[model samples]
Structures are given as structure tokens and as C-alpha cells.
Target: MFELKIERVIDAPVAIVWQAWTLHYAEWFVPRPWTLEVIENDLRTGGRSALMMRGPDGEENSSEGVYLEVVPQQRIVSTDALKAGWVPAEPFLVRIDEFAEHAGQTRYTARARHWSAEARDQHAAMGFEPGWNAATDQLEEVVARLKRG
Candidate 1:
């Protein structure tokens, strides 16, 4: 198994960051030319979280997972290894998102735990870093706009 972590200090409060991440996720989950269609987002433990990401070429990738833990404004742990009702699914990745308050800013961390080195490498080769960075940038923009309102 392999793990990858990314962190960024968002210039916003933890609440704003959390709200952007949870409530407005679809708005910034993907970079330009790509779009995320949220099929379901329950935001509770054992609830389902599913989405279909459409690429620029119109290719669609679907992901279905169950929330393992949800701590409002603090953390969220989910895995595609299991579906709703804790039913076993093909193992892929476990994602953990954590938020912390640091000097009035939001310290955001995204961790991806893969089922194998090959899976991790595949994700990395797919431009995970750049893709995620761009998504975070978009998230920051969304949060900033929402904060202004």
C-alpha cells in the first residue's frame, strides 16, 4: 500500500473551508474542461458519496464510496473500498480530509491511501498533484466568493 498527502493553508476560516468542501464540493472538485456531477452526497457516517467526473473529451469516470467518518469542521474519512451499508467493493483508495484552524486560516490536508503501490503510482501518473492543486485553487476561489457574500 502507498499513501500521498497534500496540504495547503487556505486564507479562510475553518468553517468556510469546511462548507466549501462539503456543501460546494461539486463546484470546484475538478479543473477547467472537466466537470463533476454529484449523484449523491449524504455527509454522514455510512452515507453514500458518489460522483461522475466528465473529462474534456467527454469520458466519464464514476466513483462510489461510503463515508466512514464525518466530523464537521474537523475531518472526513471515506473509502471506495466499501459501498453504502458497508458492503465490500473493489479496493481502490481511502481518502481522508482534515481541516485545522491556524492563526485564523484554514489548514487543509488531503490524504489518499491506496490499496497498492501500483494503484498509487497510477494515480500519481494521472497527474494527481497538479489536478488536486488546481482543484484546491478553484476551491479557494469558491470559498472567497462565498465569504464575500
Candidate 2:
């Protein structure tokens, strides 16, 4: 398979969740102790999205991509296969995030589609599920705070 997926029922409205994803992205993109720095967050089709994850020990991972599609609070599709202006990029994976209203809560799904099964396996070995799960939990917390005020 070429896709890795994570789904959760977050305890917040879809609007709040969408706000967290778009406005307060760095606040919850990664688990605590591993902070994220959003270099750029153009939430539009063909716009650039760049972020840096800073580890406690000064390690950093930076990812740059272009949004392939953006549908407000409904769905987002981005890929590192091309940067801003559709420049050729060293491909990694295409990420798709979907959010839906479910009984006043948010039904969220994150999908990472790799170019090859080997790439998918490498991502799995790199702690995709647990890391993404922690990020989802963090997203829920961020949305909860947004819901408060």
C-alpha cells in the first residue's frame, strides 16, 4: 500500500478544528516538547506551506510543500513533490487532511500517500502512526482551547 492513514473523532467543532489547522497550525502540528515553527502557511491552492519541527536537543526537520487543493474547512491536499510555483522537488509524500462535522464534533482524517511501498514502509519505521496520533491528540487540545475563547 502507498497510503498511511490516521483518523479520530476530536471533541471540537469542525470550524474550531479548521481554525487550529489553518490559523494556529504550529501550536499543535507536533507533540509537546517538539515545537513547530511555521515558516509559511498559505492556505490556498498552489500556495506554499513550510514548517520546521524543532527537537529538544536542537534537532530540526523542515518540510516545504505546495497546497494542491484547499477546500476551506473540508479538505486540504499538499505535496512536497513540488514547492511554491510548482518547482521540481525531491518527492516525499502527498498529505491529505479531511475534516467533517459529526454530531457537533469533528471527524478528522489524515492521509499520507507515498510514491512507493518502500517509502511507505520507511515512514512506518519512522514512527508515523504514533507520531501522527500524538499530533492528533495535540490538535484536539488546541481546538479545545480555541473553543474556549
Candidate 3:
């Protein structure tokens, strides 16, 4: 398995952290000033996962995929390997997100598993670490806001 991973302990309860992921993902999924537009959030197994990312330069990129697995707040596994209704497409990577109760906070882990080492390296070269880390930081802020209200 060629994988790239990021782990962080968010200073919020698992429930809030999970809510940030499930409900407020659009607020933190991409690093700003890149914006995300959620086309559909059918957060269930085999459901659609689609979003468009808009850059500050007016550049736009769309991602359309399907959820491979969903386990409530515990885990979310999605891939662009297949689209809705099992339509095959050009493979990129499978994303795995795991959330756990860590003492009084949330232990969050996100992994991108690619089809090959070359693919993994390509993803890393695409700024996986910094971008994901910034997104994770945004996630913490979202979680905090969710916790406050």
C-alpha cells in the first residue's frame, strides 16, 4: 500500500470533531484561499461524493466520486476510482478518514492510499502534507465553533 497520512489531536470532543467532518466539511476540506463547493453530500455507502474547488485565481477543479464505506462518525472511506452506479474511471486514490475518542478530545487520522508508489509520490508532490495540515487546522476551528454552539 502506497500511502500518505496525517494525524492530529483536535481539542474537541469526538462528537464535535465528527460533526465538523460530516456536516461542516466544506468549511475545512480545502486550504484557503481555495474554496470548496459541495455538489452533493450523500454521506452513505455507495452514495455520491462530489465537490468543486475554486482557487483564488478563478481556477476551478471538480471531483466526483462515491463513498466506498461509511461508519457514522467513526470512519469514512471514499474513492474516485468509481463513480456513482459503479462507473469505472481513471484511478487516483482512496481516502480514508478515521476518528477516535482520545481522552476528552478527538484523535483524527486521514490517509490517502494510492494505487502505486508513483501515484503516491505524485500526490505528495501535489502538496499533500501542507495542504492537509492547513485543512486540519481549519477543521479544529470548525470543531471549536461547533462546540461553542
Q: Rate the local accuracy (lDDT) of all candidates.
A: 0.92, 0.92, 0.94
Q: Clashing residue pairs in candidate 3, if any?
A: none
Clashes of each: 0, 0, 0
TM-score for each predicted model, relative to the true structure: 0.97, 0.96, 0.98
Ranking by TM-score: 3, 1, 2
**Model 2, runs deviating above 4 Å:** none
Worst 10 residues of 3 by lDDT: 11-20
Superposed by TM-score, candidate 1 places the C-alpha of residue 21 at a distance from the truth, in angstroms, of 0.7
Q: What shift in Å separates residue 48 of candidate 2 from its native position after superposition?
A: 0.5
lDDT of 1 by residue, 26-87 (tens): 99988878999999999999999999999988799999999999999999999999999888
Q: List pairs with backbone clashes in candidate 1.
A: none
Query: Candidate 3, residues 22-123: lDDT per residue as tens digits?
Result: 999899999999999999979999999999999999999999999999998799999999999999989899999999999998899999999999999999
Once fitted onto the true fold, the runs of candidate 1 whose alpha carbons sit more than 4 angstroms away are none
**Clash pairs (backbone) in predicted model 2:** none
At residue 88, give the lDDT of candidate 2. Answer: 86
C-alpha RMSD of each candidate structure in angstroms: 0.9, 1.0, 0.7
